[model samples]
Target: MNTLLIFIGCGLVTYFSRASFILFGDRVKLPETVQRSLAYVAPATFAAIMVPAVLGDDGLANLVPPSPQVGAIVIAGFAIAKTRNMAVALGAGMISLWLLQWVGL
Candidate 1:
């Protein structure tokens, strides 16, 4: 079927992309520029993912949540800047989101 073919194609592509590293990781010596560029891939990927989750409704679909998504981001940002701890920031952000949702804020 078309769906099964699509799945197989995507899986093969992902597998090869990852397997290249496992197979030839030590053999490859990338340039400094390439290495530096690769560092941004993580934040770029995070933004790519988070942008959709954050703006999915209000920015595009015109259906905004009560108030807490934006607030949660702000709180988490501050938490990271202040504490520099991912666990603490994530906990604070989740708790804030829950409270905001419960209070309809």
Candidate 2:
């Protein structure tokens, strides 16, 4: 019962917070530079999350020997560069990782 109530409270908070933007967006005018900078937010956020996970605690040291993960990232990068398709890049990365792991790196 307590958990359910807590979840409901949290959900309502989140909903209201997000809805506030839509409710008041017209009145809140941001600067052109701020709006332009917002475009980089997603990619920056993605890199922030992925960099730590990919590099792990050892950081750049993990790239010394070129692990399966690094190989997959390289393949995925190439796929995206060549095809310009996110799905293809994802598939290429996943497949390369699986293959590398299966072959014992």
Against the true structure, whose lDDT is highest? 2
Q: What is candidate 1's lDDT per residue for 1-105, written digit by digit as tens?
A: 699999999999999999997887889998899989998999899889986786655575423443677778778889999999999999989999899888877
TM-score of 1: 0.70
Residue-by-residue lDDT tens digits, candidate 2, 14-99: 99998986888899998999999989999999889877877777778769787788889889989999999999999999999999
In order, what lDDT does every prediction score?
A: 0.83, 0.89
For candidate 2, which ten residues in a row score worst on lDDT?
53-62
Which run of 10 residues does model 1 get worst, by summed lDDT? 57-66
Q: TM-score for each prediction? A: 0.70, 0.78
